[model samples]
Target chain A: GAGVSQSPRYKVAKRGQDVALRCDPISGHVSLFWYQQALGQGPEFLTYFQNEAQLDKSGLPSDRFFAERPEGSVSTLKIQRTQQEDSAVYLCASSQLVEGGEPQHFGDGTRLSIL
Target chain B: AQSVTQLDSQVPVFEEAPVELRCNYSSSVSVYLFWYVQYPNQGLQLLLKYLSGSTLVKGINGFEAEFNKSQTSFHLRKPSVHISDTAEYFCAVSLDYKLSFGAGTTVTVRA
Candidate 1:
């Protein structure tokens, strides 16, 4: 795809269930970021990956959230023992440059619903 | 640390009328500012960015924004808006690699 791609546009799970979301960044993109957007709020950074290295994961709300990018091109965000508060839109973005100022291209995102 | 605040939660405008979305930021060190627009059920698209050199930045879809250092603001504006311009806009600031975003402003353009 020309742009970032995310899998499972929508997902529904009950409490205590685990969910994994996938992100396929643009070809050759060196930087990938994941964010969570709650209803009526802006997207908040969850983690960032530079190539295959997990550079920053400070924004992650808790240890239940885990993300990995072993190949630097595809990434996954997995949540364990999901709670209702974990329900939100998970967004993935990729940028060509490793620098800070470059604009990021985003995917449509996976909207998760916890029931 | 960096944070962004968008003053208006929602703004209603008529077609062909001017519209402005206010955004303010707080950061001790140098920062990069950005504006993004998200349509319903879609991802955010970059509207503009202020990295260096220029305070006034122009973006696609005829939208522009001004970076104000003293006021710590980077408000987005358009001389005229169309129905297609109706969407949610977010303002963000980056101190390092990660970005902190404001709540967001919903713009509704009525024909």
Candidate 2:
């Protein structure tokens, strides 16, 4: 892909329903990241993957949020039993090199609305 | 731990005027500073970053930022502005690999 790509640009889920968002990173990107952005706030880190290895998950807000980058290319962010507070934009970013100093390209993001 | 604070929630400037967005960060260890811009309905794009070599870092769209370790600030500035420069700007700090972001500042460049 020319840039980071995310699927289902918008989503509306009923409370208690599960939602899954996908991210397709640039080819050969070594690092992938997931973030959550509230209506009027900046993006907050959720998780990170260096290739196929999950290096950090400390930013995941709760047990309901889970992310996986299987096979090291495509990543998925799944939220279980969505709540009203879960409504926000889910963003994906990819970096060519290591984290420091390297620019991370971001996807437009998936806007999730828990109805 | 690393955290960023963007001082202004909103800034209004006319086209061709100079603009500045204030940012400050706190970290226990060495950190990387970055400014990112988000256009309407678009994802964030890196404006500039301060790593090590220099205190002043220039970025695309005529934006620049200076890293001040003593003050723990990395403020974005532009000598002149255009209407297209209206966007939300975020300040972020990275320690090791994890990044922490500020609340963000929205800049509206009026015509």
**Could you say which candidate leads in TM-score?**
1
Model 1, residue pairs in steric clash: none
Q: What proportion of the real contacts between chains A and B does each prediction keep?
A: 0.77, 0.68
* Reference-based lDDT, each prediction: 0.95, 0.92
Which lDDT value does model 2 have at B75? Answer: 93
Q: After superposition, how far is residue B48 of candidate 2 from its true place, in Å?
A: 0.8
Candidate 2 residue runs with Cα over 4 Å from true position: none
The local lDDT score (0 to 100) that residue A73 gets in candidate 1 is 90
lDDT of 2 at A40: 96
B6-91 in candidate 2: lDDT tens per residue? Answer: 99999999999999999999888888888999987788999998889889999999999998889999999999999989999999
Error of 1 at B48 (Å): 0.6
CA-based DockQ, model 2: 0.74
Residue B18 error for model 2, in Å? 0.1
- Report the lDDT of model 1 for residue B108: 97
